[model samples]
Target chain A: MELRINGLKKYYRTGKEKEVKAVDGVSLEIGKGELVSVNGPSGCGKTTLLLISGGLMNPDHGEVFLGEKNLYRISPDVRDRERVTKVGFVFQQFYLVPYINILENVLIPTIGLNSYSASVEQRARDLIDHFNLSDRIDHKPGELSTGERQRVALARALINRPSVLFADEPTGNLDDYNAEVVLKYISEFAADGGAVLLVTHDKRISRQAHRSVRMKDGRFVGDDTNPVK
Target chain B: MSLINKPGKRISIWMIIKNELVYKKFGFITGVLSLVIATSGFVGAMILLRGDTLATEQLFMEKERELRAEMLQLEDDYRIIMRNMGYNVLILNETQSISELEKEGYASTYLDYEDVWKIAESGMTTLNHLLPVLQEKIYWPEKGMEILLSGIRGQVPVYSKPAHLTDDDQYRSPIMERVPEGKADLGSEVAVPLNLRPGDIFTIRGEEFEVNRVYSRRGTRDDLSVWIPLDKAQSILNRPGKINGILALECVCSTEELGQVAREVKEVLPHAQVFEFSSLIAARADVRQRAAKLHEEILQAEMAHQMELRREKERLASVLIILLITGASVWIFVLILNNVRERKHEIGILRAIGFSRLKVLQIFLGKSALMGVVAGIIGCMTGALAGVLWSGTGLSFSGQGSLVTPPVIITGLILAPLLALTAGLLPSVLAANQDPADIIGER
Candidate 1:
């Protein structure tokens, strides 16, 4: 699978009179099984780029293509439908519903999906076991550590086994040890032929990606093809 | 997951119900209260009205019976008075030529005296003779009179002595034996027997007659007067053929039809003064008017009472309806608002999970509707129990012990919940349509 964003522009209104460009005429492409990181300082539109790429936001002037389908060409409803089955998202805040248990959290995406089956429990069990969360499957997010919670979120993001994964500051809230563990899972996901668009401020996690890009003031600043030595 | 998915996609009613139960229990309680209020008010009014209706019917029936009885008595009295008046006219005409000496002379002399006696008694006898015919003529039966006289010698009974002074010399008059003291005080021309002590006498037509008996009047007309035989009356009047008026008292027919019967009698006997029993009683008009006024007043009062009861019932029902609707709406609104606040995150999460804005709204609203339906059923049962308890006090006019037995109460119960559901809709929809992205982004 390949993902492409062309001539993406996003603007924000401040007060009633002021307008600021959050993303300005930026474009990029990622191939199948590639792990790419979009690195930027705070408020640099890294997360915005990821959100737009995942079809969560409408760009003022842009087009995003996943495989051969124009993501923005279809209606928002159709785009949401496609995104549910074809793309996965992980947020910096974990976005794990505090009330639900880990297994229930993982099973959220399959709730109303036509292809969902009773065997989803077994699939969820498998994912929980793989993430070393079997003992904590019944525990709520409040009961889980930061690493456990992030793992559960990641498990939920990959529950439908989407072809492309977008992670926005996935390690932004984790300690060093849990951050390393999270990066390892993301790398494993990329190696297994899933495309990843990762946004992060942490250089240590960005170094693990095959391609790294830097952004500043709503513009791409650098692209490093070489992995960090 | 597949079974759950199928139902979830189609809008899960059970999920909606569960969510409402979890969130809006207080609204449910208020909805039940509303049903109770409405049902109690409506049914209570009906019960009171029914009781008043029954009482009114009873009073009307009683008044009708009394009026009917009074009219019948009046007719009976009218017939009696008319017959008596006719007899008096005949006696007066027959006795006009009789002198006192001749009347006494005729009594002494041995003669049949039948023609004179017949003439003297003709008026009364004529009525007696015509009674059977009149009985058939009128709708009611006529009354007949019988009279008899006997003389006593000392304590032994004897015939009156003729002035011939033959074998019956010891015979005494019946009047002397029966007359008590004070017969002389009535005057000397009143014939007291020579062998007896003097007593009071009463004059009839300027001639005195001894009083024999003093008793209260026993007929429908309570009159006080001297009773004298036909011959004596003729002698006192000095017209040997004349007698006092013959009275015919009647005891049949209802008073209600008396006026019509009296009118009919007047048409038949125009010369006689014909009057019913009610006409003789001076207080009759006053009594009747008073009774009529009382009846009218009672009817008016009862009508006013019923109107008041109806107005009160309506007022109560109106108040109850207003309170029920207001209370239910307020309660439902508050409950839904609180529920929305509590479930804001759930709504946000569902929206994020690809549940459409419409779907989320349906879920919330459906839950509230389900709760309303359940509360309505409970309210009906509660109202029914309350009606039973209240009816035991005899306060209810419906005469029904059960709330559900009254159609109005049942209707109220049904409508109250429907109102609650309507009240809950707007808040639920607003809560559901709130933007999930904004909510999620808040944290």
Candidate 2:
């Protein structure tokens, strides 16, 4: 397994005496070359589960394992190193830094590792070209369309060549055609031998995945394998 | 083209800060402006304070010079007046009685002619302008008139004062003129009765003499005297190498007491007793001392007023500097804090992409430091210029290298950045410690 989780729980207190179970007793696993989508409605804990599994949030009670290493067991700095070197994240909001150009934004993850060089720059350029954003490579995010910004965000995520990719609502803000283009790129990442954990509310997104799980109120309600994969 | 390549370019924390500062131009500009105002205020205050001190010193020095010049001129004027009043001190033989000298108009006892020379070479500081006189009552056998035969050689220079070689002693001190050899100076009484004039040959005892000068009429015994060389008078009186009295003017330029003159003269010549015209000497000393005291009082009062003014200015400047620094620091803190709030999602995204917390901190802090460095340079220059202009017209201080000393400029350059870093510390930490999970999940 490339990514694994067992009984992850996260609770947020709403007031003095009331608590909301953002994610409770959620467990799942994803292997190499597999794209698994967690399907649920808004506030059903799909995003929370993805966040915990991505090594970003601490689970109140459970363990998240990436390859053979437990994500929460390591020191924060070590965890940060592991995340930068072995994992990638994409968001529905396409949070590209607005002041930097698209090429620089795609190369930002390389800066986190303090490892930018000629080869990294070449790779960033190649990725920008692959995303069909070569003409807009020097333009700021504010000058780009919604689809172009998402493409830039996607390029930034894949730049580090992480073993696993965690994406939250990756297509929630895209049009139908742009949504199809983004889903095609994600399926290609899985086919290229990368693990993908995608969380979304749309059932139609699950068809592009090798497997799908339904979650409600922070727990998995149903799990199934799609034959289309 | 393969996208211009932009060779040698690499992304780093500095690049992120630069881009962000450019993007948020309003916040960055305002932050820099506040720092400039504070830094300039501090530098200007320091320069003005130093310049004022230098100016006050220069003024004091000028005032002192003027007072000293005035005192010297007044002393010269007093010396002229005392000289015109005649030698205020007459040194006669120790055993000679004042009543006998007054009744006979000449001393019965006499001193050796070398006595005057002894006092002149003694380097006595209490007396100056020494003169030796030999006078006797004689009957002019040729004119058949009784006249006082006065012998005067001229004034002797005291060893303490610089030798005055010229006869132009009118402005300096009164000097008795020397009667030329083989010639006589005839008093008005003797000259009018004998109808003698300058250039006329006259006989004194058995010696033939030319009338070198005829004196104006005076109501004193000097009007009945015939002045000649000391050697001539000594020969006529048959009193060789003898003088009845030594005449001298008491020096009143020092703080020494009037009585000290007689004591000092006695120390030099124990055989001589000094008889000074105390009223004349006393008046000269009183006027000189009063003028000196007034000069000192004026200087002290001016200094006290200057010091009080400087203290008030310093207090005002200190208050202004404190206010400016506090206001600037608060503004910087608010600016960075607001910047952190506005970039909440951006920080979350950077963290999600695996940026370490330290790198995030560097971004915010580096921006603040850059602003400080730029403001420091510009503010120091403007402050120095303003100090010069203000001092030129206000403080009357014009000293070179007073405004932009190394210590003050260096302190200002270092202080502005330190202040900015201190103000930006809390906000930078907040930006660094933000959790990506909470921020990304909220969206």
Measured by TM-score, the strongest candidate is 2
- Interface RMSD in angstroms for candidate 1: 5.2
Tell me the TM-score of each prediction against the true structure. 0.63, 0.90
Chain A of model 2 scored by TM-score = 0.98
For every model in order, the fraction of real contacts preserved is: 0.03, 0.85
* True-structure RMSD, every candidate: 12.5, 3.4
Best by lDDT: 2
In the range B345-431, model 2's lDDT, one tens digit per residue, is 999989988899999999889988988998888778887788777764545433745556888899889878988899999999999
Clash pairs, model 2 backbone? none
**Candidate 1, which segments miss by more than 4 Å at Cα?**
A66-68, A114-116, A226-229, B1-293, B309-324, B338-345, B383-392, B395-400, B405-420
Best candidate, DockQ: 2
